[model samples]
Target: MSSRQRGNFNYKLAFKLFSSFFFLSAIMDVLAEANGIFALNLLKTLGKDNSKNVFFSPMSMSCALAMVYMGAKGNTAAQMAQVLSFNKSGGGGDIHQGFQSLLTEVNKTGTQYLLRMANRLFGEKSCDFLSSFRDSCQKFYQAEMEELDFISAVEKSRKHINTWVAEKTEGKIAELLSPGSVDPLTRLVLVNAVYFKGNWNEQFDKENTEERLFKVSKNEEKPVQMMFKQSTFKKTYIGEIFTQILVLPYVGKELNMIIMLPDETTDLRTVEKELTYEKFVEWTRLDMMDEEEVEVSLPRFKLEESYDMESVLCSLGMTDAFELGKADFSGMSQTDLSLSKVVHKSFVEVNEEGTEAAAATAAIMMMRCARFFPRFCADHPFLFFIQHSKTNGILFCGRFSSP
Candidate 1:
């Protein structure tokens, strides 16, 4: 080919690649937004009881349900999409591809932290699932549909699934499927597990740790081991809500913890009620935060929480997917399947060194941080989030109210 012809071909190739890159980035952004919206919604639902600690992995739950959504049709698919904030114009394919890219990006190797997200489908051995559905799951979500004899060995099947979840979460989450969670009617189960262990970019000195009183409410207080450190970190204050926002980076800086602490006089409910996807994005924008030397005092705490999400999802306008006759997962199979249950369990521990969090979410379908030189002390009820800086995805989020 002549030099001019070769130049034209190369230019076209570059343009095509650029367009593909832009498309992928846009999809990721959409996925992130969807996650944020779902996360906040779930928080609102789970936070109704302000007396206890609430912690869970929205990422794990979203991915697991997305796998089910891959095969959902009609109203089932539409409800799932709306609840998940995945009503993008690109349709289901776009959502799946976006997750495909996200899973790959999050699980990429050679990072300073150990972060892994995995998915799998467990179906009754006798059920006949469409090959297209299986192929799409594997192709888009890297999830394989495994066959189990749910009819003959109900307990065995449950144990097998729990074992898989435990293995995926490095044993942090065992017994994800408790006794009787799977029975003869249980035809399918979809599971997603996320595990993360990372050290802080600036570790807190153990010697500086001291017992501090954490205010649960105006009338209640409890003693906690507060970890302290003085370092440079991104910090900001939302005067409108009387909240302080701080970012605490993990070792790699790719992952960070964001803490939102309402003023001592301000009720956490005030901030929670005002939280929205747009406001969260604006509050945490890089430009909105400033890096400065801060004295951080965060309590050393651990939380393990579980939820049966059928009612929760239903409350969020996802009733059709969980309904018996109304559910339509035709894209998966013609077996008239409906989601039977969605169970999620999460564990997290934060110390002077860093943080370790593991969560597993199973969809049993039956036919179904920083700092604050200004002294950012999380001595009261506050919210926290572990986010993937690169994708702006919320990996885990919770509220530490009692402890």
Candidate 2:
């Protein structure tokens, strides 16, 4: 009640707020690094064939796995923490809190764009999962643990989960889990869905879009509807990889599509081989890009892709989580549980107006879990990413190698 006491109290409150902000910022940086590393790793894994196109939301996949990581214990938790880059972000509660903060920021209301992310846990009605685990998921990830009758109604449970994912993603993603993906052995399933729609700050004139030749490779070519625009945009060049970097801002500027186009003489594989988390950070730094009026030509394309993430995560060193004997998820329940499957599906459409993208990821424990732009010109194959400017988090990323 005293003046000095009041002053001290105010100072303490301010300091606490500052500390919290700093902590959250550090966590975001760690997450961004993790996302970048994982994105490149996934690209390399899925892009073994240079002739195919690869697309998915790294954020969606990470969010789904982080929920499973919440229940993981011992080696299962350790491997997941390492693979998901939670270990570098201080691990344990910090990782969850980081995601909580991130989800809050990305899903903020009143933004000019539409970006929503939702998480949920569908557990077998008969299983006795720990109350602490359920509470923590709800508290830190805004994910509710829902009880489902996976034992007797396998097909119904699958449809229910798919329906939820479809609803969350505005119907952009449906049937995330196919008919047999879940069965009587399934006990728990963790799901995460993200949807985003935004308009370009400087929309390309629709009339300017024309059918153009897209060089798929030295010996292959396809016709694509190439959108064209000349505007002032952030552009950079990476001589090390013979790549051109361009930033295409969406309306409100909170999100942007970044494109990396390698010179025709250099194969995209070369650029992929040289990409690392550190290099990605350096290459995409705002300071490294300059704003200038340039002609941009990007193809209007739509991609709907699906992946079985069990093998992908396993190859990335997340083995114990899938191994029933070795897996440890004591924090979730006393039940001897192991991940059975991880299914992910994503849809994205890029056009003269802007972009709409949605992705859903499900970890069926049984359970387990689981662009720009620059278009100086994109007549050749290139890599692109839709990134959150504030947190530097990659929302969706892929290689547009084919039409």
Query: Across residues 177-294, which tens digit of lDDT does each residue of candidate 2 receive?
Result: 8889889988777666666677887777688899999999899899999998766689889999999999888878999899999999999999999998798889988887898767
Candidate 2 has its poorest 10 consecutive residues by lDDT at 358-367
* Candidate 1 regions with alpha-carbon error over 4 angstroms: 354-373
Q: In order, what lDDT does every prediction score?
A: 0.85, 0.83
Clashes of each: 13, 7
Model 2 stretches astray by more than 4 angstroms: 354-375
Candidate 1 — what's its lDDT? 0.85
TM-score of 1: 0.93
**How close to the true structure is residue 188 of candidate 2, measured as C-alpha lDDT?**
70
Clashes in predicted model 1 = 13
The digit string of per-residue lDDT tens for model 1 on 1-403 reads 9999999999999999999999999999999999999999999999998887989889878988999998998888889999998896445588889888998888888998876665788988787899999998889887888989999999988998889889888898888888988899987776666666777877776777999999999999999999987666899999999999999888768999999999999999999999998999999987768987677899998888888888889999999887778999888888877776688888887887743330011011101132224788999999999999999999998999997
